[model samples]
Target: MIKDIDKSDVIGPKSIDSPFLGSIPVERLSGGVKTLILMNNDSEHIFNASACGDNCAKWILKIAEKKDLIIRLGYLMDFGKDEFDIEIVNIGKTVHNSLELAETVLDNHLI
Candidate 1:
């Protein structure tokens, strides 16, 4: 139910449509800001998610090239604190670091 993904969880081996973000691990996407979550059926697990942008997603794509990308995360506030915001994070200095950074920000919300 939206929360289940964790900082330590592996998000992908990637798909032709969805891909992984290097060693940090993540699921890839296409357009507008989206909410991604990891969940289980027992109702005991949860992973916080964020509304992420295209550029941010591209940063996630970068991880494919570099696994050593360390990350720092930020948030795109939407209409104050009422509406959830888009999260921004650096996967490293390169590309896919976005995913890792995003993961870190989201992970901060849960496991």
Candidate 2:
């Protein structure tokens, strides 16, 4: 079961450098939640999940780079109303594979 995260816990805008991905911004959105937003042209794909353990950001960046679909995350906060929308395709399998690949690469040396 996925636990709900409070918005007040988010902390970041931290910049990380990568030879392949360039400069990417990562944020710890909550105790177990982390997110990264990727900009492709005018569209922004926001990736968020609770699995952002050690090395999760790097793997997430890789997933964002590999996907062909564009996903958008929208949150509405007005008069105490809270709602969100996430648009994407093959998210689960794709992200799982990407994270696994990233872990493997991290464990080994890249050439």
Candidate 3:
């Protein structure tokens, strides 16, 4: 039996299978939208995800939960061919902080 999943679990059985691990292309579209492209080797059913962009993690998680989105905790290649390591929760908080700071600065200047 596996360490976490029970014997009757459907992860490795016929229901769910992962022949290719970490082989999906995640694209960060504008307006905090993201899409996961499945690999040919993948079963076309199972996938994964980590985040969308700087502050889109929370929304991503929410939408994913309802739509049964597949999350891939892997890497993403941007248009500029850059790579980054990030989390959705932290990014959301950071963006919120930045917006708050900007608002405060604008208010002070107007006063």
lDDT of 1: 0.31
TM-scores for all candidates: the values are: 0.20, 0.19, 0.25
Q: Per-residue lDDT of 1-111 in model 2, one digit per residue for the tens? A: 012222232223475443444454544233233342332232444443333343333433445465543433222111111222222332332323434434433444321
* C-alpha local distance difference test of each model: 0.31, 0.34, 0.33
Q: Model 2 — TM-score against the truth?
A: 0.19
1-111 per-residue lDDT for model 1 (tens digits): 111222133344542222233343234332121232221112243323233433343433333134322222245212221222233333222222435544554665522
Decreasing TM-score order of the candidates: 3, 1, 2
Select the stronger candidate by TM-score from 2 and 3. 3
Candidate 3 lDDT, tens digit per residue, 1-111?
111221122343223222333222222122233233231223456444433343444444345444544445443312121322222332232212434434543444522
Best by lDDT: 2
Query: Positional deviation of 46 in candidate 2, in angstroms?
Result: 11
Model 1 misplaced regions, further than 4 Å: 1-53, 76-111
Query: For model 1, what is the alpha-carbon lDDT of residue 24?
Result: 34
Q: What C-alpha lDDT, on a 0 to 100 scale, does residue 38 get in candidate 3?
A: 37
**Which residue window of length 10 is worst by lDDT in model 3?**
1-10
Off by over 4 Å in 2: 1-48, 68-111
**TM-score: which candidate is best?**
3
Considering lDDT, where higher is better, how would the candidates rank from best to worst? 2, 3, 1
